[model samples]
Target: MSDRRSEESSGDEPSSSSISDEVWEQFLQDTERDIRKSAPKEPSARAREVTERLKGRKGEPEGWRTGPAWQEMNGRAARRRRAWAVIGVPLAIAVAVVAMRPSLIPGDPFGSTAGTDTATTPLPAETATPTAAPSAAAPGTPTLARPFAGSPALRWADGAAGIVLPKATALGAIPKDRVELALQQTRKLLVDANLNPDVVAGGRPRAALSVLDPKQPDVLDNLETSLRSPSKTHDPLFLFSRFDPKDVKQAGKVVKVRGRITFAKGKFGGVAVHADYTFVYPVVRAGGSTEVTRTIVRRVIDAELPDPTRYQVTPGRLTLLRYDEDAGNSACDIHDGYLHPQFPSQAPTGSAAPSGPSIDPYDRSRDIGKQEACGTVSRT
Candidate 1:
């Protein structure tokens, strides 16, 4: 009786080996159509998560720009998930059928075929957007206790300590010893020009000037002339970072500094040391107001030490090859001997009309370009 029942069951249903490829494909299509008609039309859970994320993004502070890569990825992922919910049915059914009845499809069961891999490819890895640390105050609003609160300089090294020097290496004809001396002198010159409290407070940068060769024709004379009488073409503040003492007073002893110093073979002779740095100074009204404002100065100077054997040069002094600067929060086109930092309460001058694009003083990714007229700043 058991043998008879087995024979009847075998006759009632066709064996897996007997099904043809065309029949198997038709079966998958039929099953997919039935499943599609039954599947819910509502968005999947992942779709709701994406929508919530977008809604939350709208609440972020104004002017806080984040990279678009992460958002773009989220959008792509949401779209892919929605697509798979519909099209994945047929693919999944096809795979299961091939597993249960491998001979029905012929050849390798999982062989590469057109449109077969539409669901298997993985999504690209995502990256999180970088964010600045929290601050006590928003940008453009400065307080004495949190002078650097909203500025990038808040994270920068304080004072001359930020002027880090690299290991001195021999360059061309110059030995390591001379290269080291050049590095040290260059750092001292930078400190004197920008970080010295006396120099910053409208006083002459005697120490900085002493670093240069006095015998160099026009170099010392030009600097002296600029200090004596400043004009648009000749401003002492171009080399020395100074502000009018009568207008503002230092809020604290800290001066935020960040940049790099590099040395290479001199274009003219010995070793050339290039210093590119930005200094952030917090100052208040000379009358001693508690409200604080910051002035940002970026200076790029190229100084060289000539080979003593080849030419006449000053000992322990550098030859000024190039000097360039850009001052932020300072009134434009005002060529006094000082950097005129504009206060929040001060009225805008005629030169305050920006003639060019807005610049972010904290952005050191590129060199500051030439300014023919007044330019606007994106931030303090």
Candidate 2:
């Protein structure tokens, strides 16, 4: 029995040993397969060796599985990656465009275009043609276009020469008939306060006629009031007679007369032409050495009168005389019949002859007496 038992045990041992060997071989094969699959093939030899040494050990925890939950999680991760990629790509493109866009801009708003050299350009010249010149005046002929025809002031007539005397010949020298006629007219004008034909023939006959009748006390009072009034006494006749006729005729006939006219210093002074006709009258001796003066007396006569433009006349025969004696080289002669207020009257008086400074008709110098200085105002 012992022998039979040993044989059976030996056989069983052999069978058991074979089975253990088979199982060991399968384990080795499976471990080799798992190591080959898990190891990285593209790794360097050293890295592969390291990976191989760690292979077939329990792998790191992998929760992903082939199930609905794994698929959904994979899908969400894909969408997130895709969204990040989309956002990052657009941001990069935008950054690049913004960085380079200014360099690509054209045309400066304030400055000139590039590649030009000059800073400024010149303006073109005018192409219009010139006009023709005006013609010149003839030589030696006086041009009436001058500011003053002949006198300094704008005169009614060209000059004083244009003035005519009452009943005097046009340009002929004053004769006895003309003087007598003027005297007679003067007397008639004084008597009737009417302008005679001779006076009218002169430029301002109405001025001489405007004189108040000496017999009419009301007229005299009015005249006196007008003379005294502060306002301008605008009697045309009175102004006409007061204006120096000689000044108007200065450019024409130059006549010297020994006569007197009333005068005032300031503006409204009634001046009349007065003359001693007795100076020219023939004296007759009566009753043996008892000299009785038989002289045809007359008021001052309006001789060769001046142009109306030269004198300032008012309706009441108020004459504004022009006596610029200073301008006439201090000559006191009555060139325009301007009577100096300071000069004594030529009429015979009871007192001895008054002696005073001669009045300059044209004395416009600043040094003339206060009365003459005030009278020599320019109408112009």
Candidate 3:
């Protein structure tokens, strides 16, 4: 029994001493960490947050070590946290730096513009310029992004409607005077709207929304809405529609149609056109019970529509103005969606179902706000 007691005591004494030594070693390392941190050096924002989070001393006195093993584990956990804090703080800064200075990156990081490439396909020098035919750009006019597709310019007007493509084939086919061109372009846009095309340029199936840019389509839709209510004043649209139910309704049949373009005073190239559209409505009677009937119709409709120069045009970007606004290089200048919402005006109400399938061949992408006009957007 004595031998066994001696052995038991011997084992217990060393085990307790060994545990105490390990505890002391951990405490010493913790003290060294505290000492290293004692000096007042500037801490990074993240490091400062970490320091406040883990506030306490290491290498505490012997009495402080008398708690559960979990207490020791917590101390180790805190030291690990401090190590990560030092590494993570710098990593966060690097990412922010990259975002702000995209120019520092080697290539196009955000997006690109359109029509700068052969994609739009410029006209060849060998092709003879027709009288007053549309071309890339006129002498005084700003350089256009693209050129006309081909000649005589109106397959629809001459071929379909039996109306000749206006021989305005003079001065880039764009009149020299801003007001004249504005009225002329407005007349053409209305004519195009009546035809209900995807997008029109010089009676040629050329540019998409860019030819009209952004505002012209809005003018057309708004006019259609106004003319639907004949009681409302729209002398200009009626004149432009040529008084045909098909033309004025812009949806039915007609006996006759004709019109002329007028102007509203404005600054620079920002002039508005008041089109005087005139037409006759053809009424047809159906049924053996009803007697034959004929009707004569003449109504005048008016609305202001924009010319290309009315909106600010950069190399690849087209800026839009609101109903009561002038186009400028301000934050208020928007460019997106047909009749896009301006700052004060929220998005115009629209039903998920369209009244009719839009003539635009392709849907405009929701991705807008591109700095360049249109280009191949991608990473280098």
Clashes per model (N, Cα, C within 3 A):
0, 42, 34
Highest TM-score: give the candidate number. 1
- Overall lDDT per candidate, in order of appearance: 0.59, 0.22, 0.23
Residue lDDT tens for model 1, 151-261: 657667889878889889988667899999999989988999899999889888888888887645566776788799986555676678787889788889999887788
lDDT of 1 at 75: 25
Off by over 4 Å in 2: 1-160, 166-213, 232-380
* Per-prediction TM-score: 0.63, 0.16, 0.23
**Highest lDDT scorer:** 1
- Candidate 2, 242-274: lDDT as tens digits: 222322112122111112222112111112233
Q: What CA RMSD would you report for each candidate?
A: 26.7, 65.3, 37.7
Q: Write the per-residue lDDT of candidate 3 for residues 102-155, one digit (tens) a residue.
A: 343444533455224332332222122122212211111001111111111111
Which pairs clash in the backbone of model 1?
Answer: none
Better of 1 and 3 by TM-score: 1
